[model samples]
Target: MALNRQLWIAIASVMVIAFVSSLAISFQSARAYFEEQLHLKNIDNANTLALTLSQVEKDPVLIELMIAAQFDTGHYQRLELLDPSGEPIASRTRATDAVGDVPGWFAELAELRVDPGIAQVPDGWQQYGTLYVESLSGFALEALWDTTVELFLWFFGIAAVLGLLGSMVLKSLTRPLDDVVDQAESIGNQRFIATPEPRTLEFRRVVRSMNILSARVRDMLGEERSRLEEMRQRLQRDALTGVGNRGRFDDVLGALLADDDPNRQHGLFLVRLVDLAEINRQLGHQKTDALIKELATRLGTVAGEHRDSFSDDHLARLNGSDFALILTDLLDAKPLAERLTEAMQELAARHAEATSLQLALSAGRFGPGDERSSILIRLDDALARAEHRETTCLEWATQGEDVDRLHGSDEWRAILHDAIEQQRIHAAHFATRRIDGRLIHREAMLRLEDARQTLTAGQFLPWARRLGLLPQLDLAVAESELERLARTPDPDGEPIALNLSIDTLLDESTRGRLLGLLASHTARAAMVSIELAERAAIDHPAAFREFCAVAVPLGYRVGIEKAGLAVTEIDVLHELGLSYLKLDRSLTTDLAASESNRSYLRGITGMAHAIGLTVIADGVRSAEELTQLGELGVDGASGPGVPE
Candidate 1:
């Protein structure tokens, strides 16, 4: 029961008991007073009648006439005159009837019985006759009943007013408790929240303790996340230069290529220090390290500028005396190549007096259909050509080679809009299976069908995002998948994971549309899981948390895809209430080798499992890799090797 209700019940019970006791006492007191008054009247009337009879005459007829006259004038039940021998001389009596408007039960409860009055009649010192008179108690019973009714009405009215007032007071007093309950529920949902302290001392103390506990937990999570990020940086970054290490570079390069966004064009620059070994032989490792660090800084500066123009760009030191910088959305590599050439000349001039340290710069641009190995090979060939030509030379290969043949963003936007309106999007399923060969779930990949070609998400998502058409595309894809599920529910009852773009997930309008679509098809919600990229989740933690807060309760599972790349901050995962974490393919490739990778995966899996999240490895290529990942505690794997 609610606190307010319990309080009201108690208050009402007390009021009823008090009202009943008061009514009983008042009724009894009134009845006693009325009986005393009647008794006095009876005695006084009888004495007066007897005296009148004695003064009038000793004759029985005269006495009887006077008594009868008095009896008629007053309200009396019975009046009698008796001779000295105790024989009745004359008597008058009348039957009593209950008054109207009073219940029989109430009259009986309030009835008053009084004794009749007796007096002797005197005539010259001799007893004339004995007179007996009794007053009627029907009127007294009626008065008692009326007073009792009035008392009951007054008590009931006052008690009702008090009950309402008490209820209001209880509601106010317990309002803080409601807030505390909501706070507790939010915490259970992995959302740490605090409530204002109540006015009551005990309640305020409880609230304060909860707030303190919440803060402590948040602080602890923050510390753990910081530690994890530090570890990630140590594992992925070069010790001499603060740029990404070879492994990190390979992961980023693979991800960019695997993304296969047709509209995306990435520029790669490979810089080789021609005289690094000679410089180190002459000036020692210290000066060589200084030179490498300076070059890394310059490359980082260029990457930063490129990132400002295009959000996805990276600089990494692939190996000793060699560094690579990748730029996204740069269709032309000539401009960036020229900039690097100028920066290299300046760097060489700075080291002119110390040593003849020249730099060889080679640049290549890769796009949707380009393979990572081919791009690297072409970049290496360009570097060789630069080194052979001249000192401090820069060369560009495959320039203006991978430009898009389709229409501009506006036309593509129009086409995408038309496709969405016509519901031309379809979903492709890729299976992920557990170690025991049992099916876990199929990941639903979106495809946009045009008159000419059916484009995969990687081929069209970049353009869709650039054109601000992701929300529409996402809605269309979700609607299609839901319709499919409605027709044929998953045979294994496993949900199909659907990817959601960061913009679509965060946009309020898009979120509403998605929710409405899901609400209408609630039965399919349980068979649907929403997947957000790890980068997006890290970029927009608050938005992701809010999205999950709304989605999870509606029976939609939330998971993170491409985890471990941009997920240095693991604390957000705890707050996100993720159902699973999909290890990016870069993290899982060749898992049997590389102790460093194995250690990182172990740490990630442990952390995820601690928070009740299953870890699934993506892009598992071989049986060996799958077995290794399973041994490492990965719950599931999905890739070419895994059966569909």
Candidate 2:
């Protein structure tokens, strides 16, 4: 039963018990009082009669007549005259017929007591005869009936009233608890904090304790989450830009696109800087890094708008002059691209003075049916098609028969996952950036060639990440690149910069594997510096540093690609003892035009060189910018600008 019902029941039971007790006591008292009154009346009448009989002495007939008259007028039994020896001398019957309205059973049940009465004979002790009488008890029985009925009515009426009042009292006490429970459930991933101002002192105290406990739990959970998130962010983010890394993009984006909900669409874009080499030469690495940070903050604001529509759309630095975005679960591509271009236009307007702030955004859209390789090829194509010094541009990819298609939604992901584990991944083409005749770093793009045309890294990246298969992909692709390097030795003794993910590095096992892969060639160790997106390193600064502590000593150096304009705190990257920094594409596309861009590139390069780090420029498509990079004293330059 409900608490209120149970309380009311208990109260009613007690009241019933009390009423029963009261009724028993009441019944007895009423009987005694009525009987005493009747007995006193009988005694008074008997005394009066005795006096009358004494005055009528010497006349037996008058005495008998007076006694009979009194007996007939009053409620009494018989009046009799007996001798001193207890024998009856004279008697008046008074009962004409000896019939009674009361049944024998009822009279026996009642069994009321009557008081004895006596009349003096021969006028005060003559001793001729003694008078006898009985008292009436009819009034006593009537009184008892009336009192019992009143008691019954009162007992029922009072119990009902008390029962209702008691239930209300209990309800008031428990209502606050019900409210507390509701508030607790509403909390989600968030924590609860409720301090009620109850009217009752006891409840108010309870609420206070509850509030304190809730706050404590919230704090504890938040602290734990912060610790775990720091580690995860380190693994999945870029160190310089403070955004997600390339691993998160490939793995996370692929999974998002695979979900073929008509409500959600997918878009990925790349933004490159035009003047990072100039910035590195003029402003130094510190200020160039600052510009990347400023640009990241601006773009992040636009991406944050779709936060609710997407679960985890990560934006990250892919390399210096190249920042990437994996927009998961979008409604459509056209509007998203349009909105992005608008956002970039606004960003450019804000940093109009920053020459290195010139951003060229190349966006690509793909659906569930679209092939991963084709999408990436299309993005590469879009970049190739991007106008010189363009601020914003967009393109949508279509599905073709040559691209891998699965039977069901999950079947395709399964195939890709199997391919990565078996080391089926192969490299198709490599673009290397050199300082003069020395080959320093090479950007290795993967190709899945299986009984068909070559597949680009983009095709598998999205799926691999989505299916939680990037670790496998990272291993396969890195190992393949290393194997190819072992076969094709570079004539130039320059350091080789190969693409590496902070995700794989943070994983001790993967880091160990990478170390083992590079262990054979001690001469190539300094030549092969692993490249990563800065967002990953920054997010996991501590862990990345820890991994570096182990790996850097093993003769493996780290390089950061997709380095943005600047970030909240870029000191973490410098402190980690990184070897090289690449400017993100967003800041470099129009380096020659924007003065702000010149300032930023100068700032980042100067900072990097101050820390004994080399700055490599990627996506340098024009010869004019190439000559400008040489003037800026950039350590190296990549993209189509290197006399392709």
TM-scores, all models, native as reference: 0.78, 0.50
Tens digits of per-residue lDDT, candidate 1, 53-136, equal 778767777767876887788888899988889898889988775466778898777777777788888878787778999977
lDDT of 2: 0.62
Worst 10 residues of 1 by lDDT: 303-312
lDDT of 2 by residue, 1-644 (tens): 77777887887788779887997887667666766776776667667776666676557677667767777787776678777788876676544322245454544555567676766666555666777777656556655656666787888888888878776776787777776665454333132556565777877777667677666755654444344345444655678887766654554445444432322346677776666797567667887788788777766776766543332356777777777777654433455566777877776676566553556667765555566777777776666555363545543433331233323338647667657766667755445565573566556666665445545554445455445555666778777766666676564533345666545766778777766776665555655667776766656676667766655666777777877543324444434546777766544655665454455566566556645678777767667876777666677777766653
Model 2 alpha-carbon miss at residue 51, Å:
3.2
Best by lDDT: 1
- Runs in model 1 lying further than 4 Å from the true structure: 48-96, 120-132, 146-176, 193-201, 251-269, 277-315, 325-375, 391-411, 430-442, 478-496, 505-528, 540-558, 570-573, 576-580, 609-614, 620-644
Error of 2 at 273 (Å): 1.1
